[model samples]
Target: MDVQEKCRSWTADHLRDSGDCYYQAVTRTSGGTEVEFRGTWVIMAASHDYLGLSADPRVREAAVAAVRRFGTSLGGSRAACGSLDLHEELEGRLARFLGHEAAAVLPSGFQANLMLAPLLADGSYVFSDSSNHASLNEVIRLGDAKERTFLHGDLTHLEELLASVGEDSGKLILTDGIFSVDGDLCNLPDMMKLADSCGAHVVVDSSHDLGVLGPNGAGASDHFGLRPLLVTSALSKSLASVGGVIAGPADIIYYLRFHARTSLFTAAASPANVAAALAALDILQSEPERRVRVLDLAEQLHNGLRALGYDTGSSVTPIVPVLIRGRERCLRMWRELCRAGVFTTPMTYPAVRAGREVLRVTLTAAHTDEQLMRVLDAFEAVGRNEAEHPR
Candidate 1:
């Protein structure tokens, strides 16, 4: 078949079988409180700006200064010409922030995983959590490494899998420090203990945990007092900037800097992103109360949803999913919430499994108690209406 015909056929089949798999874009203002699409303002509850620093004035100032000094792009890969003083500074600050011996910054978190997976190489087996973020799964596929998946957050299953793998094999146990969809934390201390017993290295993707978990926002490892062999995180979520970082032993950082193809091919993070992340790190280090406030808000929001008769499913982080049973019902709820001035995303099918559609709500530190109460009120109203109408 011709390329156009093949593309058309695939599209037709996909639309016929999965017509409900679509997303709507709602333009957001700089403040992040107001979202406008098709000329209507809506309150945003779907963002990953956990610390609410995306539009913070200090962060903006840092970005602006960096842009003036360095322009917009890094222009080349780190191996070539992209490395800058800001890059080294950010890496150093992040390493210190996470209590790691060294850290390396990449263009994105996806690349960090893509690089690390293959760097571990042929004899290694990857033990990944079933509920890990898609990027890690993609890394496992691209690396062409032997992999086993344990049940989501089931430490017993993880231990069993680790026990089955031989001790001589280099095993890398990979999991999200905080599972993105459910906002539930991994049982890190237990997982670390199991890995230690089995002689496996632990790699945690703390994209959702950094700037939100642990004392002083050191992340899940610190929260549980169990250090992993390595930690990877995205700056986009909590740090409210762009770029990714991998933190571990100095040797691992050195190896990835030289051998990881993704790092070798892609341009390093831009100066502005580097600067903004550095500023965010400074804020996180000096004022740890921000982390406490964000966690407190998350707890309050989760409790509020539960009190209103929503099934939030064991979430202990900033992300809370309200189970809505059917795809249509979930979308309807999302639309209703949006119209009622609270914007959230409807997650269904591949993002989750079939029969587990939900309205995913992410809480941020910027949201006030009044705003949270308003969100709860909207959910309560929708819940009552949906119950009465049975749709």
Candidate 2:
């Protein structure tokens, strides 16, 4: 067979055993924090709805209003007639929220990285974290810059690499502010210090931390009290929308606006997504309690998992991973959790390690304390039962 067919054939047996659940769809949410999956109410632990603003009535109304006014498509790219008033407003609001001089809203956070990295990569040596998101890695490879990847969150190693490079023209350090899989926060302040010492630029992809970090949800930079060279985030997560933002100096945004091919070629975000993002920002600002609740519940979940002898490696955020190691055991636990009316996703091989597979669970503000307890109970019961079989 062809390459596509060959790949499919290679993984068909493995996928058939446990990967099918990923394709299953939820008809609707049974509760704000639970979904109706396969005719059962499964508590949601696999989504990025940290603040639960995606289902907020105000966010929904804002989206509806935009749709009513703008229809659907916005014609051409931002460089063309696709540039709308909503886009500019959203960009400005995001900049102010992040305490940045300016911002450029993109179609998606992925596209933002794909475009921005190339612009900054010219005449530069790149220092990237090994565990950063795929988008950052893609942009680095696409660019002409020479790149070095240090161990995840290893600033000493990063500094060593930077020191060896000896001040390149466009020295850039790329990292995810909040790692998606493990939910570990990168030390941006220390990274900034290293960048400063080495005369390098820092890029913080805070896609997973925006609208859920900082004292006021300003983002990871604000949380660390340091202003990096560049900050980027996806609106889809806590922003409850479907776009991305690149916040930094206005001059940089101006440069990217003119040079970033992705922005120049791709159309602007839909009016509904823009409006929803704006609404989500408002909700995030007005309701700081949501962030508190999410973190609290996450801590509780983390603790419970640990007490049950599940190895959750270095996570302090809402995303909790129960490192189950073996693929078979991981799939078995996932299946058991699903059967027990708990919805979760398993992270394996490419996402993590083959021998360090995990059941990745994310908590949101929408999850009630009672629901959290029930989820823990499910794990407790399932673990107890699975121990006897050990399959």
Most lDDT-accurate candidate: 2
Task: Summarize candidate 1's per-residue lDDT along 131-246 as a digit string, tens digits.
Answer: 99999998888775688999988889888888887779888888999998888889888888888888888899999999888876878988887779889999998888988999
User: What is the TM-score (0 to 1) of candidate 2?
Assistant: 0.96
Q: Cα RMSDs of all predictions?
A: 2.1, 1.5
Alpha-carbon local distance difference test for all models: 0.85, 0.86
Residue 77 displacement (Å), model 1: 0.5
Mind sharing the TM-score for model 1? Answer: 0.94
Q: What is the alpha-carbon lDDT for the whole of candidate 1?
A: 0.85
**Pairs of residues at least 3 apart in sequence or in different chains that clash in candidate 1:** none
lDDT of 2 by residue, 249-343 (tens): 99888998888888888988999999999999998999899999988998999999899877788999988988887887887888899899788
TM-score to true structure, per model: 0.94, 0.96
Best by TM-score: 2
